[model samples]
Target: MLASRFGAAAVAIMCAASAPAFADDTLKKLGQFQSTGAPGEIPQVEQGGKKAENLRAIAPKIKVPDGFKVELYAIVPDARHMAVGTNVGVVFVGTRKTKAWAVTDRDGDDVADEVKEFAPSIKKSNPNGMCFTPDGFLYMAEHNRVLLFPAAEFFYESPDVAVEVIAEQLIPKAEESFNHGARACVVGPDDKLYIPLGQPFNVPPKDKLPLYDEQGMSGIIRMDRDGKNREVFALGVRNSVGLAFNPKNGELWFTDNQVDGMGDDIPPGELNRATKAGQNFGFPWYGGGMVRTKEYQGEQPPADAVKPEIEFAAHAADLGMRFYTGEQFPEKYRGGIFVAEHGSWNRKKPVGARIMFVTLKADGSADKAEVFADGWLDDKTGRYLGRPVDVAVALDGSLLVSDDLSGAIWRISYKD
Candidate 1:
């Protein structure tokens, strides 16, 4: 009996070894569908739940400014960066997961009426960067490629809307890491598309520096709408998950996640401003700003490394930010910035998981950073109910915050 069992097990192992290796299912499904077929019904589309009970339970816990009120806008799963559509009451959201989502408010109400999968035909891997041009084109930056959807607002409901590839193999496919794979993109005032390419390592090895520098890794790169005139805009950006162009002067501002494993309060996260191209924000050289990392402690850094304009708390994991240009808020809020701190994962005591407000001076520099909203993380238990990832200003001038942890988009509006 023992001999017979052994023989059977050997046969099973041999059969398993002979089986063909499976290809990625998502890649096979790419470009398979292109038509919506029917209104309000798309296959594999998941709608955002109302979740009234869950909203009521957490609504009171969220603390905003005195005159502002927070309400549940929509329940978007794995929501990350957002792009507000022009002339269409639609909000396009990117995700670190498989799909992108579109949240719409059809009846002129502040609340979102529908949330559905965007371009179900496309197989997206970490499509976490989205931006809209003034001309009504929507561009999405995925892990391995960039795509442009022409007239996205008008043709979003139709699956057959035109799709164009801006670029492929934006980053080296072999160097892809799950830790910092999500890319952030924005359309700059210069009519160029800017995308950040984060280095795969916590502190890149000495041997990899030359290759990284040559490939524009750990830096921001800009190119024309057709992917021409590509050049490195900024360097030494460890992992910037958010990028925004200031409406006043067209300067670029972004949030960088500092290195991990350091003591809690030594190296702070960064809010950096790049006034011109070819600037380098200190990274592995100076983890956040001043504190140096052990990996490159003895090495010399670029002499012209620019410092951060504002420093956030250590391990804050600042992700997405947008300058407040809307008129719905108080006068003080105009020209200010709203940042979503996604919270820290490696900290012994968790920090962040809130919305931060940065007041800017007339010259476009930040004066101070303050907490705009809180209560997502429980101070007593070190537990977070939601992790805010991105902030977008709606057409009505309300602020929309996307929380990937809670799978919800929240709206903060002011009342007189």
Candidate 2:
């Protein structure tokens, strides 16, 4: 029934409106299908007051799979990408402002009873991402630097301690703008910190710098835990908001957001798999294998530069990739890749704003994209409830997707 209505309605809209309108409606219809329940609300948790349980959505309602349930994990007010500690049983998330938080399930009920502010009044240059290492130390990505605090301090009893700068003065400054900031970081299989530095203002570079420059260093960079041995791990990437190392195959995967100013539907965004240390996925010169604008006189990728493993629609704004290693879902979904699309602002029509699952082949490659959660972006009315920014697997093997638009977190788990 839904398909029949969508087919007819889409054809008429496609015929009447421009390609942007047609693409928006079609993608929304594809992303709108989910077994929805009552709305999930954000709970207000103060320092001492009783943590509120029932909070309402500041944006649109979230959607999830069948037999799967969703609840508001934490209403962080401006939450970003999340990091989980396997040993600590604690979830750490950051905000763009001067604060980062640790959400913990103390009583083991699988719900966060306590949400503590770890670093307060932080410098809000660009607090983008955080992650933990196999040895159990916590790391936070400060723009051009990293602040490391003891995980034991957050879990055990400790006063608010100043974060120690394990890495400093690493990222080179951009001349015009630093919008990309330090996007995300993760400890790879080699036990090294893999951090992303984006292009400066999306402008093409005229000449390479003797030291580190923004254009050349815009890709993923790798460093030791002590911030030593800094080198470009990958190149030709404009901005990758989220990245993860696959547990099954030990390969690094990333979601790269393309440049703006091209027509709405020119080049699709990319889900790139980093096969080697120095692989260069096309950016600036070519996006999704489509030639982009000639502005800034960007150079196209060399014929040797690799293409994306999976291509999403233009301006989908894909972020945060996580491999689902949970038992709640069917066997086929055990190790699939889950991505959060933050939705598009420059496009005439909206895309993303939801959590999507892509089935993986035995070779650790993507099959086709599927909607694991929806309703963050409205389908019928063409509005958005919230924009999903990041996704992670919780302690209980459930999925947690962060809504930056509404300052909320939605937890998903499957049941019989």
Candidate 3:
């Protein structure tokens, strides 16, 4: 059933990506499919009923810092990553699954009223990470390809929106893994799309490193907005789910999920800063933060495996993050960062179903990191009420947190 729905785009992607001639033929067919979709016709998600109430009930348990509070914004199932629209403040959410959603508050009330699938006719596979360019083009980085939607916000009301396949075959078919395959992308200050491709295995063999590196399967790769001139931007990443360019200095910052099975506490997760392209963050050799992986213990890591800006608790599963450019919050948070820790799944004692506030110094280095909101995990029973996957800042200065575990988008705002 799943394949029946998303099969066309996926099939086109695989075929078109094999060669340029085939690409033109298959992708054109897909675009023809795109333009024929019914206008002003959108399939909607069931917004009201028990699910929304249950999600709202969990909001009271969400403990925020003083002067801030969180409320249920919208019910967005499998919300993994988010990008606010360039013109109308619509929030486009991507998922690890085939579906992506467009959420709108519609009234500037800080609560989304409509939640609907984006490009419902496209049927792309795992259109997971989404980023909007300054000029209004939206990039959706899928498992094996990257797509561009021009005027995504304006055209989103219709299924017949103009679309382009920016890049093809992000990873070879044999090398792609369902694990760690949710890609995260962003339009950098340089007008390029930076996409992080996670290595599939817990720890890959040494012999495969060169192939992975050549394809940027274990690192971040960037290309021109139109998907031209592609090149690897950084390397040695295990699985980076979050990518943000600091508005202060245009440096890229991302959160990396450390390797698992190294015990719950041995390999810490990372929050890295890429001041320049081609930097490496240790992965197979060092699971995270210098804790070498047993798979490559005897081998030498890259000579310049740059250290992360901040090392998070082991197995915290840090995911989406964004710099705080909103004035709704106090001065301390205005120029800082907010990150969503999806929390650890297999830790002996669970930790990190929370949002973190990291204050940065004048030089763009992190000065401190602390929990800004939590209580998603029941301390008494270890049950998770919600697991946050991404953080997005709104036009009104509110913070939107996407929770796949709870199937909701939460709005966090501050009042003096």
Candidate 4:
């Protein structure tokens, strides 16, 4: 049939092109899809019931400022990052697993009415980071590839939809790792896709620096929306799961998870700022906040390595961050920042499992970092009730936070 549709020569050429893709499981899985679905074919995610009630039960435990309130928004399994669509009021969530979900509120209520797997026809890998462009294109950043779904909000109901491959094989197969596999992507002011390619090691050897730098693996790279003309935007990053662009000045600010194992309270996490291209944020050399790593202690870092705007507590595991551009909150929250501290993993005493609110000065400089919401971590027993992953502003000016532990999304809004 293919030969009849595209001539004998064209079919031969296409077969040769696709022959290599079958060799890799990652790309092979992506090819398993259907243009349509059978009876009861599409997978559906239950929206409410016990799982949601449990999340609501934990809501009162979540403490917020006096004027603010927290409530259950949706029950999404393994929800990691969220992207709100333009005009449709649908929120697309990505997970570290294979599923990405589309959360909807059909009755104009604050709570979600439906939660379903998005584009279930196509298989996926770790689609953890995602963001939407203003023009209705949803970009999903997998561990090693990026996929573009146009009109995602409107076409989410169908299992089959148009999907475009923005980039294939972001890194070599040999370089892929389960550690630090979460990649963050955002559309910059210049309409370029800025994505961070994390290093696979806690502290890599010195000999690998040049190769990693050339591959843009240990840095943030920006490419044209069509995945052309890619260049490294920043270097020396350890692993940054969060990326946000300040609206006022168009500068990029990100949260970097510093090197671990130094001690519980030694190297600190960082929230960095980037104003231009080719800038380096100290990594391997300085694990976090000027503390040199043992691996590269004998070596010197770049003299122009940029320091962080705010240094968070060690092992806080700061992940996704976003600028507060909504108006439903108090005036103080306007033009501010909201970052999710995923909490400490190996720390003797757990430090964070909360949402941090950062204030900006009149000149758009970050001034302070304070906990806007907490109670996710039990101080006495060191138990985690929930771990917040990412934060996004809803269309109604509220904040939607994704929690992988609870497999749910929570909404924070101001009532007073």
lDDT of 1: 0.83
How many residue pairs clash in model 3? 0
lDDT of 1 at 4: 17
The lDDT of model 3 is 0.84
Model 2 TM-score? 0.81
Task: Show pairs that collide, candidate 3.
Answer: none
Cα deviation of 328, candidate 3, in Å:
0.6
lDDT by residue (tens digit), candidate 3, 164-242 = 7778788889987889999999988887789999988888887888899998978999987767788999998889999
Candidate lDDT (C-alpha), each: 0.83, 0.68, 0.84, 0.85
- The TM-score values for the models, in the order shown, are 0.89, 0.81, 0.91, 0.91
**Across residues 172-217, which tens digit of lDDT does each residue of candidate 2 receive?**
5543245666468898988788887776655455464323343345
Q: Which tens-of-lDDT digit does each residue in 49-153 have in candidate 1?
A: 346557547867889989999888888888999999877769999999988988888887787778878877667899999998775668999987898765467
What 10-residue stretch in candidate 4 is worst by lDDT? 1-10
* Shift of residue 393 alpha carbon in model 1, Å: 0.3
* Prediction 2 global C-alpha lDDT: 0.68
